[model samples]
Target: MALSEREQQVLRDLESQLHQEDPGLADTMDSRTTGPLRLSPRHIGAGVALVLVGMSLVVGGVVVRNSVISILLGVVGFGMAVWGVTLALTRVEAGGGPGSSRRPSRRSSFMDRQSQRWDRRRGSQG
Candidate 1:
């Protein structure tokens, strides 16, 4: 349900107060985005390279005669493929970019708040 004008105004006031009191927290909260994952070209390139190398290794493993060597190669190849997939699927942060340095304390505090909320929810459920 949509908020009424009065509720909206109150929310705005609260947000303004939050910004004034803790600008870092406000900024971090505002920077959060939802929806589709955005992948960078660099990530795509690296992930693809790893995946290709992995595929080649897997193929080589299948062709090899020795069971021990084949098994090792196959395991490594599977690991590399999974890593590549994970890297490729990872979302890039939009607002700050990867290079922008944020206060460590702010992040930890936000995480702590989320953890507390999760704990509270679980406690209520159980």
Candidate 2:
């Protein structure tokens, strides 16, 4: 289901706050993370191609009177076509590429900064 206007507003507000606090955090988020895969056309085409290839193999087997090899080849072709179609629908890279600035996931940058500030205050107090 689609997000309601109010829900969208809330999300935007939260994102705005995040951006205000962290300059480059929004760049880390993938725009397509929430969107649909949109694989309908490719999926349908793959299904139809699979069916056709399998049917052809079956018919060829009947003609040649060799069911085993025909079934195997057809199954392989169908699997490959379906895999290709699935790959086509998927995106290449998720987040921003090499040039894109990324915050260190393991770095406790925020907490470390706050702690440093606290240490400075404690030193000054002493």
Off by over 4 Å in 1: 6-28, 34-37, 95-126
lDDT of 2 by residue, 7-123 (tens): 999999998988788856665564445543444544456666666665665556556646687667666666665665554454433323234345443255777998899999999
lDDT minimum window of 10 residues, candidate 1: 93-102
Give the root-mean-square deviation of each candidate in angstroms.
16.2, 12.6
Clashes in model 2: which pairs?
Answer: none
After superposing all C-alphas onto the true structure, candidate 1 shows an RMSD in angstroms of 16.2
| Index of the highest-lDDT prediction | 1
State each model's CA lDDT, in order: 0.83, 0.63
> What TM-score does candidate 2 get on C-alpha atoms?
0.31
